[model samples]
Target: MKVKSFLLTALAASMTFVACDNNDNEMGQLDNTPKSVSINLSNVISTRGAGQAIKDDSKVSLADLQVFFTNGTTLYKGKTVSGTEAVHYFSTKDDFDSRDDRVFHFLPAEVNKVIVVGNNGSKITEATTYADLQKKLAIAEQQDPQKLDLYKEVELTSVEGQDDLGHPLYKANVVLEPRVSRIEIGAFKYNAIAEGTPRKYTSIEVQQVMLNNYFTTADFQVGTASTVSKEEITAASVFGIFEKAAQAGATNPVWYSDVFSADKSADPATKLQVITLGVAAQYEHAYTEGNVRPAYHFFPKDDAIGTTNHPQVLVKLIGTKSDGTKEPLYLATSTFNPAVTADFAKIYVMNFEFDDEDLDNPQKCVEVTVDVMSWDVVPVTPEF
Candidate 1:
């Protein structure tokens, strides 16, 4: 049954969309007007199931973790916030787990909404456009960093003559880089609901494994690369959504399933599901090179069903009508990319939407798979 129908048109330009706070709220679409919100983040490394462990396979010490919020898609003037490193103080755990505290702030009056940029690059991978780096990141995060550790070596030493390029290993260049073990993010804040129900998510956790870096000396192996095919992009490939959902119960039960799709061709076309779910939650990893400069990557609030972000994501449906002519099925779904602050930590009660077509109740179950890919333009001169 078609639940209902409404036209969706995002009045703001996402890539160039500025903060819609008080400045432009009066001039834009009413539904997506920028509203006030508070964001909070909690780092629960110890309690998370992903098993928080730093993969310092490259012999690098963690300098610090900072979360950036941006009004524009890029992470420049956007509010910059740092995540507090919480050791074993908050919870009872074995080895110390570094986590973060909460950071919530009101949207600046000049911005429409905010977006987060999880800067995970020390060497600046943001130099790559959405096309080049998206695939690179997909492949890198999937690799096992343990191969480069020091303890895994056998005692076979090839003696090299100083003049002979043979056995003598050139004063081997030792490199230590921290591969993110576990990345956790939580609710910064949200639009207060009628009842005192706890907000959707308080935190999320991701894990990584790499060779340990504590050893003073050892043979460091050369780093390898990875590959990701278009086929590799699917719901199963997405690991952040379910992880977050398990942590936070659904404020909107099928929000993920509803907003994850690429069916711009659907009869109703792809549209945004703007449930009163004024609530938005996210957890993403900004992989850093040498552990600095992050490119924001976030998980949609209900992406377990399908990945969502920047305009909602959706999976389509195919149902038989009484007449039998194929109609643009309204999965009654769409993608939502909320405007976020620069801190990358604020849980802005997202006043965002997909200015797409109208959707009604979907008739039949449509077999669809949604893959959320995040990439951006790399200008000749980067602001940062």
Candidate 2:
């Protein structure tokens, strides 16, 4: 009886071992190949404080977004699982992640790093290399000079988990960096003269406005040349919207007061105009040649006060003298140095107030006070 019991136990143990071996073989047959990757873009949001009265107003759209991979030396192309060129052409922000159209598959173990550039209403193609990307940027800039390019990088050194089908799943998020700096020029005309003060001027009107020493992509590494000289790039004119108000009650006459900001605390008769411009931001490292930093201005240059070069003038305000003759008043210039950061957008709000300490000499240099308002909005994620 003892020998029978021992033999029965040995037979059961053998069967159990065979069953475990079969399960191992089945598991080994499952596919563990790297198929596709999922990206989450919902974390892209503005980093500015909500309490600020004024904020940076720039629209962000993922439609026509293009992405490629780089292993620091070699570049690899990525495409959607359906074989269509990979693009995040979503019209609305809703359901950014749930959509199956966002998934892209790359070559197995080839996606070491990725660079994503945001689309500002421009078509983008697959750039297999860094040189291709620079070339593409130049073409895009020429096509849409006013539009901006937001760039971000992602590292795929780590893997998330497996998909339902048991493929190697890699997940990432693309956070954007603002490649342009925003410039907002606010002009406030102080025409109100106290009863005892001397009359300063009859009236003033804004002529042409120009930005001096503004940086473009052509001024930096993204341009055609490896190095850009200051003389190669110069100033650009910003033709702002001008509205002429008719006499007191003229028919269909637009009131200047109504066109400016809602803050009507100033005299209704005072003249004011606001114009905004978007300029490309420069990288400090790009300006540095070797160990010495060149005199190149990485920050946006503002017209310095009392500078003979005519400080960066927002508008060439033509002031009417007491004799009814029109004269030029250098009323628009600021000393504000505006810069863009990696995590947020920098907007330079310049308020120019014109005042004459000695009313007797109205033609002399008018006292111009410039107040620079800096707003840091637009959040950017850390480098992956």
Candidate 3:
């Protein structure tokens, strides 16, 4: 039977996170008026292998976004107006100005630097140095309220005011880099039901997405957007899946209860199961100069490790036996790689394809494939 699946591919495109007026404002002449600037948020698209780009279909909110302004010595901070908590779904776009906090007051003088923190989980209001900012991020991830979707972005840049006519224009577009990777499992199923049995292979129920040994390494600086060395990407408790039970209103969620049915003759390529690993880190691939691939320190999936197994199991599949006993199916052997981009954000696609006669044997089943990608973060180029 011929089967077609979503092949992960890489595409070339440039993007930025800043939004400013086209007016050629000159900053040489400024009065006592403050500049009116708006905050913009967008994701850096990563280059894939050969598949089309998949949109960030999930919707997120900036309710907890934190803003900071500094001049290397003094610092100013504010919590921007919280727009729709979970308004719409899209990868990147300018946030709507729906709250009173949308308007910020900045002096017409030379503003040294500006920092924007997306989804601030640590309640970080201010920071003096890069190390301080890193510490704040670590603390936030540890105490992150494992919501349905948990992702964070941080952008930092130095800026001075611009003047068009006599108006002060000081808009600093802070591009946020993703701190975590999103692993989604699609087409998950196994051949278990007997050919003539009354119980047809309808669906496979997933307990939860699990990863044995996972960790995150420091790729770029929060203050300067500079890449760090391996020595910098230390073992600082930056690994593991998001706390499942911590998710609101999720009580024993059967992640994927519905199975996909496809006509092999008509549509040779059909996906049978879809599962999302939620938030996870990609295992490190050897680092290379000028080449950006999300690489973390390799941590073997040691089931009998010093850590607890309350929520570290990557993928758990339970199949029905001929005798009607529901037993958990262990992956005899598997090959899966999570995609990591240049800036450290990721898209891990878990491909599970059942062999033609695997259902007839049921003992040996499935091959897991993983794809990784790299990307560069730039300013957004608006289209007409």
Candidate 4:
């Protein structure tokens, strides 16, 4: 698979920090005067895709922003030189209109590391160290696919020039990445069934699509390359599956979920747990190539955790019989390639194609093709 890259611009705000007094400094800080330092934040997405570069309308909203400072020996929460508050809140976009409003003040040495977090709420306010903040999990409800939770880490570097006061300056460009992954469902293509099939349907109308056995929470830290053992993965309470109940008179019902995990045994029945995508009724026809649905989002999943059973897509269909009767049919996609793991900031486009087959065998009736793209890029059908 060929991977493509795209740029998602974030808030163009600069943080300014000043120097403070430190007696027990290993680097031998001689300057006691306040010096200005600046830091900028940007977001870049890299994923496997075709040669098309399309832009998406997803914006980065920072309801709450927090900054942390570390110098490998000590950890400190960023605060203004005049105030004791470390966390900043912006209720509207206009709050960041003023240049002084975007500026942050923190005391640090010449060489240090800066960590920035956005929209994390008040979960990590009491966190005293960077390690404690990294272990925190961002829940599904707290995250929005449109307005993502952002995190970035950068090492501060000294700039050649200094401010008007003749104080030395330091700066760094920080790239904040989203903590969730997205999956989009494209148009469906119906194929002709083999001749002389036992059960034949005049037409098939897809009612709903879902993702089964997906994670509901992810760590705030990015690029965590460590893999958990199967026992540890099963013991964690981070997975969920969706279930739908039919209403008495409503044309479409609501979907609910519960904590779920597949059993260790390789049983096909265990793959039925799912979360509905809630596709619109007008775009539910299987034979129509123009009908497309909205994109669904979820957190990253470790491929090594479930060696045999990973996340799968489930499609609900209403098939019409030759005698004017309707029957319900369910089709599920095969397991994802274990080699291709779902990571943060990545977008997956899944196209589901179905043909008439035995209703009892749901997994074998449909063929699915997936195209992976970076977030903020328009999803397109890929050539096989």
Candidate 5:
């Protein structure tokens, strides 16, 4: 499937901060001069390969926006508001139309840096200093993967014009990026032929799928690269074990996870781990070339092409022979290859194909092809 990139257009209106006095003694002396400033926020979903850009707001929607004003050290506190209350919440796009909904009063001169977080839910609410907020933002909160988008602007430049009320106006164009990557499994195909005859299996039922050696936690801070030392890689929390029960009638199943750094070492004990898929009675159905497959989302990992740290996919299967005899089989992908590097804001489609060799030798790896593209683009029909 081919995907086209989309952009989250800038808010039609800016977040207007009314003049207010600062009383936080930890911030040192701050200029509380009365001034109103307007800040404009916009986001772009990055693209790769080849495709035309389109406008799609739903790709990256903002449930609420939290803005932090810092004087290069402590958070700038307003006279009557501090912590989360000072941030503005937008229940819907229409909320952006109301001036009252965008008002966040603060002393302009007291702020040297601006930090904006969107759709964060309640993970971060109160912080005394910039360092405190950094600590909170460093670790990703457990929530729906789609809602984890961060927008940051180190400095805000003031525009030449003022508002209708003669207050100074500030505007900034910032891009928002998802902290996680997505993996999609397209339709499944069974091409195995009988060992002695041309007859093939009547049906193949997929029981379970598992993703191994993926990162369970991610750092939400923008532009920070993921690095894990040998000692840290052995930590139990460094890798995640995720499994999903494939429903008999469901078209597709999806999983979300955090980013993982690549392990350069070749030591088997210290290298990245692989997971196994177990068969259970959750559900069972025959999957063919037109049936929608499953998908998994995770933090980007740069696993070398031939390294032990490369992530693998395991699938448990039940095959019905021509004579009606059912045989249990296991199919696993050697690795998510071609492009082992999983980056943020990208989508990877893994197509699984099984042949006679795979059916005869269940321990052998299946032939898997991977197709990668940018997220939010319209998907084309898969070539089975």
Candidate 6:
């Protein structure tokens, strides 16, 4: 059992939830969907870790398989609140191994959709990415204008691809209206922002493809292109990517002493490029006049938070006292993001709270640190 995993020293980071079961694996329930009839990604798969429990971040890339699921329902990332939903799966591939049970919990939203793509075509799986689908659909619309209408009802679903990881890969498809073209907002999910803006457009749908979250090395543009395991490198890559983003947009940069070791060796006055991941998150918010974003992050309080900057839960204080005692002493609020940036330009949002006596609320309240920095397109090692 030669098991390999990404060993990450917990950076200064925090997650907002921990929705897993003992056996250490469980997912959100799907809306009205049958358990017997899941969109299968694989009929079978070969792996040694069959009965062996999977640790977090371990992935297996699925090989050959078939996908089966409800053919004609417009599915998105979200599920019906009051109805039973179908479960999702992922295949066990060498390249993409399932961390735990490889279960695709259909959370009640689109962002959770794990993107899966077909062999080069735009048709993606539940694991497919929305952005990629949009890109491919746009290309198809431009390529074949005359055949556009004929391809109108063109939709896609997961074809059984692999096992465990198989189900998620194979059956996941763009669950949306058939023949009826639709589009959604990106980045921000706030309804008000979506309804108010028009930049958001419907992805071209003359072909069979959908949006998902299957990230790849294609996103980065340096060094030898290789697909690393999700847990092993995704978070690290996210840190690298944010580093690139920060470098590209940072201004009036400041560096802090490493959280691991308190050393003021680096001069704050001098522009410091590479900063520790922890300190970066502490200050990863927006500055300037006014950019009203929510402040405070809650945890399922899951310890193993994903490296990817995930949808954080908003914090709201609720009180009254449990023992039916005096009025609950309202403490403070907090904001947290699983951000792992190598370098940040502007000041990012803060996570620490002020003491009870410190009522100024000046430390980190009602503000977000929009880190404008560049991610590491290449590894920051001496060899490179």
| C-alpha root-mean-square deviation, each candidate | 25.2, 20.7, 14.8, 10.5, 12.4, 24.7
Residue range with the least summed lDDT across 10 consecutive positions in model 2: 11-20
Ranked by TM-score from best down, the candidates are 4, 5, 2, 3, 1, 6
TM-score of each: 0.20, 0.50, 0.42, 0.61, 0.57, 0.17
Q: Taking the tens digit of each residue's C-alpha lDDT, what string does model 4 give over 128-243? A: 66676665443334233334567876765544445555454556666456665555554554444554554366666655555555554566675332332121111122121112
Q: lDDT by residue for model 5 over 1-384, one digit each (tens)?
A: 111112111011123332223322244443455433344443422222111222222344455666667777786643322424443444434454454534455445667556666666654557757776552232123223334555554555534455555454555444555555544444345653444444345666654555554555455654333442121121132222222222311344224221111333433222211221112311122223222234444455454422544445655566776687987665556545454454554555555665556656634454345544544322212221
Report the poorest 10 consecutive residues by lDDT, candidate 5. 1-10
Whole-model lDDT per candidate: 0.21, 0.34, 0.30, 0.43, 0.43, 0.21
lDDT of each residue in 15-50, candidate 2, tens digit only: 000000111123444233334555555433322111
**Against the true structure, candidate 5 has what lDDT?**
0.43
Best by lDDT: 4
Candidate 6 similarity to native, TM-score: 0.17
- Candidate with the larger TM-score of 4 and 5: 4
Residue range 137-237, candidate 6, lDDT tens digits? 22112111111111111222333333343233223332110011111100111011233442111110010001111122212101111232232223224
What ranges in model 3 sit over 4 Å off? 1-59, 72-74, 77-110, 121-132, 136-171, 175-178, 191-209, 216-328, 332-339, 342-345, 355-367, 370-384
Q: What lDDT is reached at residue 179 by model 2?
A: 40
Ranking 3 against 6 by lDDT, winner: 3
Q: What is the lDDT of residue 298 in candidate 5?
A: 49
Candidate with the larger TM-score of 2 and 4 = 4
Residue 261 deviation, candidate 6, in Å? 30
Which ten residues in a row are the worst by lDDT in model 1?
1-10
* Residue 207, candidate 3: C-alpha displacement in angstroms: 6.0
